[model samples]
Target: MNAHPDTPPASLPLFLHDSVADAVALSAVDSLAPLLGIAVKEAEKVVLKANECAAGFTVREILCTNETREILRELVKLLASYAVTKTGMATCMTRTPTLDPDALRKRFDDVREGMRLHELLDGEQIAAVQELFAKAEIAPIRFDTTPVIATRRRGLESKLQERYGDYVRVAVVDSAATAQALLREAYPVLLVADADEIVLDEPGIISIPEHAVADDSIVYPEFVVQSFRAKSAAIAAFVQLVTEFDERKTSSLLDKISIPDLEAVLALLAELARDESAHKVNLADTVLSWEEAINQEARFIAQTGGGADDFKAYLDEAVISMADELQLAGEDRDLLLESAYENLERGPPFEFSRAHTIRLQEHYARRIAEQRYFRLRDYATRLIPYEEAVNTALKRLFYLDFLFAVARFSHEFGLTIPEISSDGLGVIKGRNLFLVDEELKGGETVVPISYSVGSTDLGIFGATPLPVAILTGANSGGKTCLLITLATSMILTELGLPVPAERAEIPLLPLYLYRRKMIKKTGSFEYSMRALSRIFMREGPKVVLIDELEALTEPGAMGRIMAALLNHLPASTRAVMITHLIHELRPHIDLKKIRVDGIESEGLDATGNFIVDRQPLFNHIGSSTPELVITKLMSRVRKAKLRAVYREILQALEKERDAWP
Candidate 1:
């Protein structure tokens, strides 16, 4: 299926690149990567990073909604039934070039001529031509020909036959009269060319410019030189390797039917062309040479006398025998044999007539230029559909991974998507998401807190949602944890994921969490204040959580500062501020605008531990009692009776303490 048009944009609204990294690190979200079961690279691609926030949120929404998530889960199950993650898509159907096969064959012949010319040059010269092509940004070909080296046509033909005797054929039909005479021969000697000197009107007789041999040798063309150089270095290296190995070992590698190994070699060659290195000069030429070499081998078999039909079989046997001698086995030996035969497949037919060869080379030059132009066009247009198909599949797969991760996370934490509310938030038994795993591991129960500030219903008369909450409590009484729980739930809800709560009614808004530890250790209070000021300047609906705002200064002084700062805060944002200076700042806060809440602690539990209710109480500034410390120390007493005595004393003292503030 195609990606939806509404797929979230990739850009993030906040800190962009660096912010995600910080969030992932500080929030310990990377621990979820393994649970997703995607490739690390793919996981990184989909992780909740700032740059990918939009897409991630979109995906989160898709997976969070119960209906869409169920459909996606079923699709994944169907894919699992197939026993494969993805299907291979075909790139192209035809093996032959489509731009006029006949003309292309002719062009290919010209290129083959260039390949032959390459065999004449030394390695150093081949290297030079390759460099020239790369710098000139031309097709990697050395098409220039050297002047004819032999005066007599027979002499050059004989040399070509001798050097490439396996596939080379020499036909010396001097004139139209001579060509007619060859028509009577058992083997069909098709007249490939008709020259001005001897115009032959005959079936299978193509035209040419001249028949007589020239005195000077034709220089090898530059196109052929460049193309060959692309692969000459690699071929030369392999050849050198062959020479270095003992005969048996060499046979083992070549004669074995190691398809994977053979494919790996081809893959390596393809990769070489993709390299940013200078040797990338060989990109197209490497494949061309392989094709041209096979064509030439097929020609040798066709033109040679005696057992022409058995030539390929004979060649395969010879190569396999060599492989067997080197101790290659089974598929390895078969692989080598198959490779040898396949490379011998006739690629393109062409006559070696001098005039015809020259004319074809010129045609080849023009074809290469056209091919280059069209290749760019094909890449731009043709590649996109395939890229989109693959990308869509990837997104689908990642969606599945996200579903799996969320399913697991929900089960582990007993999470649920909270109902979207028109007012502020109310969470029942909320737990800190980050600490859930740790607490579970330690066999310590996570204390769940029920909290609320805003109104959840619309009254006929009027209803005012509580937009601000001030939390005050004793030290180590889970005050910070409650704030984190609220902030974390909001963050998760905004991402379209479930929250760690029994039940909740939360408004969807941009969430901003500020903690003292989030500030760099080197940063001063003024730096933090400036950062906070900058955030408040932005205009948007936000849920802001401030933890330990009193850490900026002494509680008394910080209380007044917080009061002044609260006056300037945008009314658009719903804020929860956790502070120790609540008593000092109470008069400054207009009670009508903000709500006061506190976590109350009873005297002590049976173990003499502080019995914090872990539930926020409305309209109360709870006592931060030091008596709980005395009870905790009493629990460590060797004598149980002594602990009970201390607990009773503490309870009595608490009763007489006369509630402070």
Candidate 2:
């Protein structure tokens, strides 16, 4: 199909990605030329394993990063160009099951007499196979994935028995490397796209329709995907690590607190890698202060024990004495006294400890009983006036630390963090990149974060030298902003001015993408587990962009899987995963939220069309330079009905494209 209309003009300079080894990735495309051509040479019978994510008679909509399909198509086309003889192709990625005899036959005859679909397995009787393989599960899952396993088994066995009768030793290509030998060469090159659309619905076998207009096609956006606590914990850990690292590497002031070596600190940081239950210890002073306070209270409670529950009265007396001795004011002393009571009763709290201890059990219990009492009379405990001095300075204490610095900067510049209640929702933009194809160059597919009133600093992740970004949005709201002038800001950033903001931290990364293929959210895997696992290993400043992670699998399973992956990743990694399955991803990635440019309540209109009201082309799009035609068109469209009508014409043209072949 022709490129989407709103895709950036092909002539733009940012369209290309330059790696350290080469100036442009043109050779990267050429690299596949040979592989595709090779498939044409020796393997006339190709049993390809395509990961199809569609209903019947559908093709993948995303481009560039849907490498598995793209590479296979290239391989098939290249082989055809090579003039291979009697070529037969079979794929495992299909909307329907091969066991569905009628559907299988229909799929087989679709383009060629032997062309099969993306998912299939040929074997013994369909009834027997179905009974033997099916596991039985709920929605978004194929409980009986046995057909797939069986189909491959049967297909290969038939080939083995038929041998030459089956044609040129079938060339096989699948994500399952173990079965590679079942095909021709046994060693097939892998071609993959690093970014694509995140699935939207469960059992994402149903493909989402393209944007209503060619220019305003809806893609998803990346919101913070991690659960609140999970994300906070990760960010806390990251902040701790980075700040500590800076103290060591840059400040050297940490020399006073730094241990001679990790050996001097803990015997085996490496050994913990293999062990599951190892207790982790933190640096000195970080929690020691909190612990020491608890310990003092614990010792007093233990001493007062002996079924002499009335001894608890001594705790109050002791507190009174200490408060008077320290010359503390009532409020100041009350907090300490209250903290001490809780430590004696509850043993520990989320405020200071991740878990609790048994040795101090009774102390903690009594502390809980007298907890409110202390808080009630906190005014009376004239203890040292110290708490105020400690917490007086900062207000950004989510991690128990203040960030007046960030606040001051925002206030000074009159920048406001977008409030969820604000009229204008949020913004999503891409500066510049190579003028790829429609699904790519245009801002159709974006992984946007659910952001409130402010901009975030991000490291750049695209082909080296040139910047290319893929954003996925919610079903409707994200379509327009995906590209248009959003790309302009990216261009300005490349030109070396701050990208319309005060700070930006852009890093380089190896992009991995996946488009359509009903990705079932399994408890065992996050969306694109195989894809992420394959590429997540690359070290240093890499961007892991996923459009629809939750749409990849069942809803229940999607959350668990995404959580697992997020738990496994270090906080340093940068990633963007966009999907309509917001709840599923919010547990992992940070949100860059945006609201509908206009009314957002009506989901799909009566005609199965997206009903988001379009905003004027972003006047504030930073400095790169937006296409004049792009800006002009964005402002003119006012009616959803009109836009939908226009989209119909585009679809007609798209359908006509198929008539060409």
Candidate 3:
């Protein structure tokens, strides 16, 4: 049950306190699951749970990051050697039946009762009378001598014939010499006679002892009871093993994982390997083959109406097919065919024998039953002792699959464990993972941007970083992408997962919220205000990312609202607000409390794309640079008058740019 024994300790932070944070965290996981080669639902459940437990992590837990890394490394190495598939792991999951000890004991008792000789007696009396003897003297009949002794002997023979007639032959011989002759012929014979008259030294001959005859308490051999118990337990355990153990291969990068959890998985894997190597018996295959044979016979009977002729033909085909399936030949094939024919001749389903077809069906049923009882008995004898261990190991194998998936994700993405910061958040060379592939497809690499908020020093920002900042930039200057990158890094690090950054120092904040830019619509402004107001009300060390709040109202009023909101935010919060109304808002905000950062466009390149620096500049404001965009359009225009009009507008924009900042 303690599958995650080495999970993060109490000092680690979680970001799922509110629905917003959960949305952000889940979105991050959903985007990461495919990259990690795991199912989305599985990743969400495991990653979120781990993050929740990681809150309030102790110093020891923080130090264990290295151990987590080492475990992931080991998993990666193992996966490199073994190309395990989900289908293969599914095959390893065997279904074992629940073998209740009491039920098994009852079954054994029932079989034992059936094997008892007293069950056949039912208070019958033997009346012995004078009878002719061969090579023996008929002395004074001492034991219930009467003429009815022959009749009593015939009744006993009938009962024995009813019980084991198919598997054995019962003969009532007048003398021991006749029993010895039958034994010499190698016939399986159970001899029934008066104790005084029955005496044989043959190995194969079965006879009741004098004591058993006097007590009327003979029973089947002890091995039968023992075999029955073994088979019951083994079949149940085997069925469970087949059905439940569904661990898949793990070979990718994962978030932070506990060392104890990893070691536990390794131990279970070792135990399973050892058990498999030691037994060397293919019990599953044997069981399946017998089941297939029975199923094929049943279908044939159902289709052919179970005629004697049809059964003989089916048996002929079954022998060859079953022999190939079981890889048996010669005597083994002959023995199987002989057993089937013998069961057919045994007559009647013991419970329902009115129909000939029903009796034929019972033959196939009994043959398969016999096969399972013997084979499972042998397997169960060896497996019973390790039942508990095997079950536990299988359950642990499932945990192993989760770990492997996480490891493989981490490995493939080249994610590194981020340091847990007590103060601000900082990422050195952070790239937005969500855009990495798309950017690459466009023949351009993702520009890794480094930025910091709060007091964390990244050596690029010269001055001390403020806890609150207003982000401004030209259109398509990567301001929104930067916010997303920072948010992604924070959420991932908080969840104990590696981030898409070269180096990151993330605060262990219990709350994280990222609100994407909302388009201006009726009631949307009210909704946005309500959502943003909750951020100020919350009291904790947290991180908040908001984009384009100015779109909600007029520039002047929105600027005042932005200043008031930023000023009212708790000092414990680190926040970044992306907006184009900085010029209208800067007059109302306290310069000492808030910093301004910008992503500036450096005009157009030869391809007519904006040459922009994606990294934000600390303590600077950026222009929207509409004039440069207009200038690019002017070059593509053919009308002389339109071009002249653009030139005049550009001249006016130049004057405004020069006077604005």
lDDT for residue 273 in candidate 3, whole number 0-100: 43
Give per-model TM-scores: 0.44, 0.22, 0.47
The lDDT for every candidate, in the order shown, is 0.47, 0.28, 0.49
**Cα RMSD, model 2:** 35.6
Among all candidates shown, the one with the greatest TM-score: 3
**Candidate 2 per-residue lDDT over residues 1-661, each given as its tens digit:** 0132123223321211111011011111122122233332221121111112112222322111454334334423422221111110111111111222344333323322111210122333323222321211101111111001111223453432231121122333243443333212221111111225332221101222222111101110001010111122222322333343332233221122222222211222223223313322222242345456534664665677632244356556755665554344444455546644655554332133223222122223223222322321232122112212111110111111111122222233222221111111123333111111122435453233222112232322211121112232334444333332222222222111122222323321222344334344243344456566754454443333444555555786776665555444433443333444333434453222321111132234554444442322221111111122222333367888876765665555335322321
Per-residue C-alpha lDDT of model 3 across residues 71-112, encoded as one tens digit per residue? 233333333232132311221121011112333234223323
Give candidate 1's error at residue 49 in angstroms.
Answer: 8.0
Candidate 2 vs candidate 3, TM-score winner: 3
Number of clashes in model 2? 107
TM-score result, candidate 1: 0.44
Candidate with top lDDT is 3
In model 2, state the lDDT of residue 5. Answer: 16
Q: What digit string (tens of lDDT, one per residue) describes model 1 on residues 469-567?
A: 788777777887887788666655544456789887777655556665655452577877875675466676556677776666678888888877665
Cα lDDT, model 1, residue 152? 17
